[model samples]
Target: DPAEAVPAIAPTTVEEVNTRFVVLAELYEHDIQDFHALLEGHEAGDERYAERVDISARAVKERETA
Candidate 1:
Protein backbone atom coordinates (compact mmCIF):
# COMPACT_ATOMS: atom_id res chain seq x y z
CA ASP A 1 0.00 0.00 0.00
CA PRO A 2 1.04 3.64 -0.50
CA ALA A 3 1.16 4.09 3.28
CA GLU A 4 3.89 1.46 3.50
CA ALA A 5 6.11 3.14 0.89
CA VAL A 6 8.21 5.04 3.40
CA PRO A 7 11.21 3.15 4.73
CA ALA A 8 11.08 2.15 8.41
CA ILE A 9 14.53 2.99 9.68
CA ALA A 10 16.44 5.58 11.71
CA PRO A 11 15.33 9.25 11.97
CA THR A 12 11.85 7.91 12.71
CA THR A 13 10.93 10.94 14.80
CA VAL A 14 9.13 14.01 13.40
CA GLU A 15 11.80 16.37 14.79
CA GLU A 16 14.56 14.50 12.98
CA VAL A 17 12.70 14.65 9.66
CA ASN A 18 12.00 18.37 10.07
CA THR A 19 15.68 19.04 10.89
CA ARG A 20 16.77 17.32 7.69
CA PHE A 21 14.39 19.45 5.62
CA VAL A 22 15.57 22.62 7.35
CA VAL A 23 19.19 21.88 6.47
CA LEU A 24 18.33 21.21 2.83
CA ALA A 25 16.29 24.42 2.63
CA GLU A 26 19.19 26.45 4.04
CA LEU A 27 21.67 24.88 1.60
CA TYR A 28 19.56 25.62 -1.47
CA GLU A 29 18.29 29.03 -0.35
CA HIS A 30 21.00 31.05 -2.12
CA ASP A 31 20.81 28.88 -5.23
CA ILE A 32 17.13 29.77 -5.59
CA GLN A 33 17.90 33.46 -5.29
CA ASP A 34 20.61 33.27 -7.95
CA PHE A 35 18.20 31.47 -10.29
CA HIS A 36 15.52 34.16 -9.88
CA ALA A 37 18.10 36.81 -10.70
CA LEU A 38 18.70 35.12 -14.04
CA LEU A 39 15.00 35.28 -14.91
CA GLU A 40 14.92 39.07 -14.87
CA GLY A 41 14.97 40.47 -18.46
CA HIS A 42 15.96 37.09 -19.95
CA GLU A 43 14.18 34.75 -22.37
CA ALA A 44 14.65 31.00 -23.04
CA GLY A 45 15.10 31.50 -26.81
CA ASP A 46 17.64 34.29 -26.53
CA GLU A 47 21.08 33.98 -28.15
CA ARG A 48 22.69 33.96 -24.68
CA TYR A 49 20.42 31.26 -23.33
CA ALA A 50 23.16 28.65 -22.93
CA GLU A 51 25.58 31.18 -21.48
CA ARG A 52 23.01 32.37 -18.97
CA VAL A 53 22.30 28.80 -17.94
CA ASP A 54 25.98 28.05 -17.43
CA ILE A 55 26.42 31.20 -15.36
CA SER A 56 23.50 30.29 -13.15
CA ALA A 57 24.81 26.77 -12.64
CA ARG A 58 28.19 28.08 -11.55
CA ALA A 59 26.53 30.53 -9.19
CA VAL A 60 24.59 27.73 -7.54
CA LYS A 61 27.71 25.61 -7.11
CA GLU A 62 29.65 28.51 -5.66
CA ARG A 63 26.90 29.31 -3.18
CA GLU A 64 26.66 25.70 -2.07
CA THR A 65 30.40 25.48 -1.42
CA ALA A 66 30.62 28.86 0.29
Candidate 2:
Protein backbone atom coordinates (compact mmCIF):
# COMPACT_ATOMS: atom_id res chain seq x y z
CA ASP A 1 0.00 0.00 0.00
CA PRO A 2 0.54 3.65 -0.36
CA ALA A 3 1.52 4.11 3.27
CA GLU A 4 4.24 1.51 3.02
CA ALA A 5 5.87 3.39 0.18
CA VAL A 6 6.98 6.14 2.51
CA PRO A 7 10.43 5.89 4.03
CA ALA A 8 11.04 6.12 7.77
CA ILE A 9 12.76 9.18 9.17
CA ALA A 10 16.04 8.96 11.02
CA PRO A 11 16.39 10.02 14.68
CA THR A 12 18.10 13.32 13.98
CA THR A 13 17.69 16.66 15.72
CA VAL A 14 15.43 19.23 14.11
CA GLU A 15 18.15 21.91 14.18
CA GLU A 16 20.54 19.77 12.22
CA VAL A 17 18.01 19.02 9.48
CA ASN A 18 17.02 22.67 9.17
CA THR A 19 20.63 23.81 8.93
CA ARG A 20 21.40 21.38 6.15
CA PHE A 21 18.24 22.37 4.27
CA VAL A 22 19.14 26.07 4.40
CA VAL A 23 22.61 25.42 3.05
CA LEU A 24 21.28 23.43 0.09
CA ALA A 25 18.61 26.04 -0.67
CA GLU A 26 21.19 28.82 -0.75
CA LEU A 27 23.40 26.86 -3.11
CA TYR A 28 20.47 26.23 -5.45
CA GLU A 29 19.56 29.91 -5.54
CA HIS A 30 23.16 30.89 -6.25
CA ASP A 31 23.43 28.48 -9.16
CA ILE A 32 20.17 29.76 -10.66
CA GLN A 33 21.29 33.37 -10.50
CA ASP A 34 24.67 32.54 -11.99
CA PHE A 35 22.93 30.82 -14.88
CA HIS A 36 20.73 33.88 -15.42
CA ALA A 37 23.81 36.08 -15.69
CA LEU A 38 25.41 33.65 -18.12
CA LEU A 39 22.28 33.71 -20.27
CA GLU A 40 22.36 37.50 -20.37
CA GLY A 41 26.02 37.45 -21.35
CA HIS A 42 25.31 34.98 -24.13
CA GLU A 43 22.47 37.11 -25.46
CA ALA A 44 25.01 39.88 -25.88
CA GLY A 45 26.82 37.79 -28.51
CA ASP A 46 28.84 35.20 -26.61
CA GLU A 47 28.01 32.30 -28.92
CA ARG A 48 30.50 29.92 -27.32
CA TYR A 49 28.72 30.04 -23.96
CA ALA A 50 25.11 30.52 -25.01
CA GLU A 51 24.24 26.85 -25.33
CA ARG A 52 25.66 25.93 -21.94
CA VAL A 53 23.89 28.81 -20.20
CA ASP A 54 20.59 27.98 -21.87
CA ILE A 55 20.89 24.36 -20.77
CA SER A 56 21.65 25.35 -17.22
CA ALA A 57 18.66 27.69 -17.05
CA ARG A 58 16.34 24.95 -18.31
CA ALA A 59 17.68 22.54 -15.71
CA VAL A 60 17.09 25.01 -12.90
CA LYS A 61 13.54 25.61 -14.08
CA GLU A 62 12.83 21.90 -14.22
CA ARG A 63 14.09 21.40 -10.68
CA GLU A 64 12.04 24.33 -9.39
CA THR A 65 8.92 22.87 -10.96
CA ALA A 66 9.60 19.45 -9.58
Scored by lDDT, the top model is: 2
Q: Which candidate number maximizes TM-score? A: 2
Error of 2 at 42 (Å): 0.7
**Model 2: how far residue 65 lies from native, Å:** 53
Model 2 over residues 1-66: C-alpha lDDT tens digits? 989999998888989999999999999999999999998987777765787899999999999999
- Listed in order, each prediction's TM-score against the native is 0.37, 0.50
Q: Provide the global lDDT of candidate 1 against the true structure.
A: 0.83
Candidate 1 per-residue lDDT over residues 1-66, each given as its tens digit = 987997786536888889989999987997888887787546655758888889999999999999
Pairs that collide in candidate 2 are none
Q: Where does model 2 exceed 4 Å of error?
A: 1-10, 46-66
The superposed Cα distance between candidate 2 and the true structure at residue 25, in angstroms, equals 0.6
- The collision pairs in model 1 are none
